[model samples]
Target: MAGTDHSVAPIARGPSIVLVEPQLGENIGMVARAMANFGLADLRLVNPRDGWPSDKARAAASRADHVIDAVRLFDTVEAAVADLTYVLATTARPRDSFKPVRGPDEAGQELRSRIEAGQAGGILFGRERFGLSNEEVGLADEIVTFPVDPAFASLNIAQAVLLMSYEWMKSGRGENSRPRFVAPEVAPASKDDLHRLFHHLEDTLDEVGYFYPPEKREVMVANLRTMLTKAGFAEPEVRTLRGVLKSIDRALGEHRS
Candidate 1:
């Protein structure tokens, strides 16, 4: 709700989110909110219980109007996904049918691959109370299930949508798979820079008589070098550390004088 950036364009095409006989308008709105969060906009409703154009849904969406504005209404599950090339049904229980069952991550990758190949795809969500009947599950090509505790595995429609949406985004390739923001770029310290740091630090330690027993000095310095190398410090970090060592060296010199 808080991160919706109106300036950024929403993803016009991905997988169709087909909700079969959704009971509440708020849940519909929440579903839209989830879709928008992950750049999904196509929302298809198969006989929403409280009817369409719901103000409650709009309020619940928290300004994800792009998804709500282009909502498509269908009379049946078959009709809703009729145009799509592939469909995955969300269910918690095992079905008697022979459809290939996939977890959310695999389902997301499959959907992303299909969509990238210019195929239409969709996911079916059933009624909030009982979920998809076997008849409804039969409509989808594959079955996607969440790995939840068996004692209480039922998930809210919005939560189910969110999980799939997140996976869908993650399954993308290159820049599409990455999150909107990342850490600032910093140049890595070169091997020369690191070698310089190692010598500087070792020199300071030698001046301070830190390495006792001349035979163990080599092993101690090697261990210190190994520890510092593992950090993979950036150029700025290396410079800062060098400055710290210089300060210590100056302090030592003043004390000796």
Candidate 2:
């Protein structure tokens, strides 16, 4: 929540995050924080242990108030997912039931497709200690299981939510799933600009006797050219290198004089 920008609107559309018997208010708050990160709102809690509107949750959320403020509480899993057309239950353990199991990425793509087709979707997260009951998982259309070490498969409620939320955002955004900021765009140095740089550098090196065994100068120059070409310098970078070479050449000339 360090980069929380209130000026930009939060994503209100995605899937509903339904927590089944989540014990801690802090966990609930963290779930809200995860939801806010990927633009998913509409948190539904089914029988939270300590009760709702917790101060601890708010503190843990790190100022993701939009998600916490709009939480919807329910008495049962059945009631919690009543309005959702498609539901995905997240569980680390494999069940005896034969519901189609999907990885996080596949589940995310499916949710994005379903949501785009005008269907409401929800992802169910079980409790901290013991996850959702077989009956609770029965309500979901598909089951999503994370790939983790079998010995330590269990994940924190917030971590699980964050993983799914990230996948959901990636599936929806396609190639656009990237950070908000990017390096400034500068024009690439043209071949002509690179050639000029090569000449200037080679001329300065000749003055400095950098290339030994005069016969190997051609190969050395070719190697230098290859190395510089691989850098793919921008126009500004090329100009800077040329200026540096000019300064060095002038300095060497003055020393010789």
Q: What would the TM-scores of all predictions be?
A: 0.67, 0.67
Q: Against the unseen true structure, what C-alpha lDDT does each candidate score? A: 0.85, 0.84
Off by over 4 Å in 1: 173-257
Q: Which lDDT tens digits does candidate 2 get at residues 1-257?
A: 26667798897699999999999999999998888889988899998999988999999887889899999999988678766667799999887565688999999998997687666788999999999987677656678999999998879999999999999999976463546886655565654566678789998898889999999986687667656755657679999999999899889889989
**In terms of lDDT, which candidate is strongest?**
1
Clashes of 1: 0
The local lDDT score (0 to 100) that residue 203 gets in candidate 2 is: 88
What is the lDDT for 245 in model 1? 99
Q: How many residue pairs clash in each candidate?
A: 0, 0
**What does each candidate score in C-alpha RMSD?**
22.8, 23.9
Give the clashing residue pairs of candidate 1, or none.
none
